[model samples]
Target: MGNNHGSLKKEATQPQHSTTNNSKDEKKIDSRTEQSGKTLVDIPDDLMRKIIPYLGLIDRSNLAVTCRRFYEAEAKAGNSKNSEIWDSVGIDEKGKKVSMYKCFFEDVDDESGRYSIMRTKRMILSLKKTTPATTNAVIQRIFRATTATKMEKLEAAMQLNDCHSESQSEED
Candidate 1:
């Protein structure tokens, strides 16, 4: 009877250990995948933090697809508290100013807008120096951005016009 109890305990503990190990292995495999279709393990968090602010949204999205650590670092660096990183990309402001500045941009997720404006300006500057072959691609990207902004503005105007018409109809 004693020997049977000991064997049962060993059987229970061994499966638990294996299941835990299997879960950890799955997480490791998932986190090691890279956006560039390669497997990379254990990129230092400090290096990711340092490099993250310099990347545009597209670059960050590409990098985050590769590793869990990079994705966390990107999320941390996106907010107002990371103004030093934003300043490095040419949107100059102290970290303390972020909260107050954000209040004025209440209509949208202002962090993206600030980052986009800075990146677009930098891209425009870069376009000035690129060769003719690269110019077309750059121009297309800029045009697409401008077109999107215009469409947003047009949509807003349409919404406002609809509101006025509806209110006038209600009065009638």
Candidate 2:
């Protein structure tokens, strides 16, 4: 009976020891995984900035907010040169003209309007100089016509009359 009791005590103690060893092993593995994750920190700022232009507007915005370092890096890299970045400036898909400084200025308050206008004008000037003359003429005509007829609904309607509207009422 004494021998049996001693053997039982040994078996229970051995299992407890093994369990403690297993827990330690698990902790070591967890720590190693964490350290491996930290290894990604070695990526350079320039590479990260280069990658920012490919990201969507929301992703870029969130990433910019992540740290001031990232913001400066992105700005230095000219990530704002990416066309998608203009979405934050409130130029929607319909108004995405390289020449439309007004769209950019309209989105910001008066305090920032001058800067936005200057930046947009610079971007427009940087566009390819060889753009077709016909395209320029058409755009200029549209701009002049729109500005001249802005407050006159009938004139605006007359200007658009040549444009085909898909609505049945307009067709009639």
Candidate 3:
């Protein structure tokens, strides 16, 4: 009877200790959540709409692909200055469309540069008579030309047996 009483007392004490640990763990979790910065989902849609105008095409597309909320927010924000840019790009079989910037843009020097390019691309077509097809083809041509130049250099080097002397005349 004494042993049973002792065991009951231990079980009661064990639960108290476990409950204390659980409360500590919960506090830690709460502190961690506070320490973690706000995610995109945490931002209000109205605020996001205001911020969308400042984001470049790539950044906007990235946010759109992050989740459905961002995608909806972007579509409603009315910041899509160049709607035709999306038309030149095709949708995958899964009904997902890749961003034109990712497919066509070679390099973006910096955020400011990217923003300027985005602005130019948006405003240029309206001012000019060129169609999106023409613009896409021109961009693709530039990439092809760059690739061809690299291939030509590789071929020339291979033909030269990878040896190109910097100095034409040798001094003894």
Candidate 4:
């Protein structure tokens, strides 16, 4: 019975399995993620854009340098809202769909993200601050120069020449 007691105790206790391999793999993944940067890079651009607005400029700039994907995504997600930018310019109708346009950051249009007036405007404002001021007669001059307003004028002219077209079109 004394000899059987040792075997019974051994059988009753569960064997402790070593986690050496798993620990090594986990450590590797942790180090790789830290070295490569945050795993947030894997998120989709649209969703990322919503999250982007909540981050301050400093944080955005930091994340921007993380990777090429983040840079492009950050640029697209900057202060601009596609509809607001488009509507403000009066050129919303010029582009078939703003979402389809090429993003400024990416040279390759094949997979480039959406264009952003907010990003463009931000750049313009930064430049404006550094340059000498040129006092224009009125802000109206600036408004007319916008691409959207220009396009709207061009469309009006073309429709104006089309006398046979319905007069109802002019009301728009």
User: Best candidate, TM-score-wise?
Assistant: 3
* Residue ranges of candidate 3 with Cα displaced over 4 Å: 1-37, 80-172
Colliding residue pairs in candidate 2: none
lDDT tens readout by residue for model 1, 85-149: 33322232222323332332232234356444444444444333344434444434443443356
- Find the 10 residues in a row with the least total lDDT in model 1: 1-10
- Model 2 lDDT, residue 135, Cα: 29
- The global C-alpha lDDT for each of the candidates, from Candidate 1 onward, is 0.41, 0.39, 0.41, 0.39
When 1 and 2 are scored with TM-score, the better candidate is 2
Which regions of candidate 4 are displaced past 4 Å?
1-38, 80-172
Q: Name model 2 segments beyond 4 Å from true.
A: 1-35, 39-41, 78-172
Rate residue 61 of model 3 by lDDT: 67
Tens digit of lDDT per residue, candidate 3, span 64-140? 66655666667666444433333333322221222444433323325334433443333222212333443333333
Between candidates 1 and 4, the lDDT winner: 1
- Candidate 4 collision pairs: 91-148
**Residue 28, model 3, lDDT:** 49
Question: For candidate 3, what is the total of clashing residue pairs?
Answer: 0
lDDT at 82, model 2: 31
**lDDT of the structure predicted as candidate 1:** 0.41
Over 43-153, each residue of candidate 2 has an lDDT whose tens digit, in order, gives: 467676677677654466566555555554444444443333343223222323645444433442243344433433333333323233422332343334422433442
TM-score, predicted candidate 1 vs. hidden true structure: 0.28
What local lDDT does model 1 show for residue 57?
50
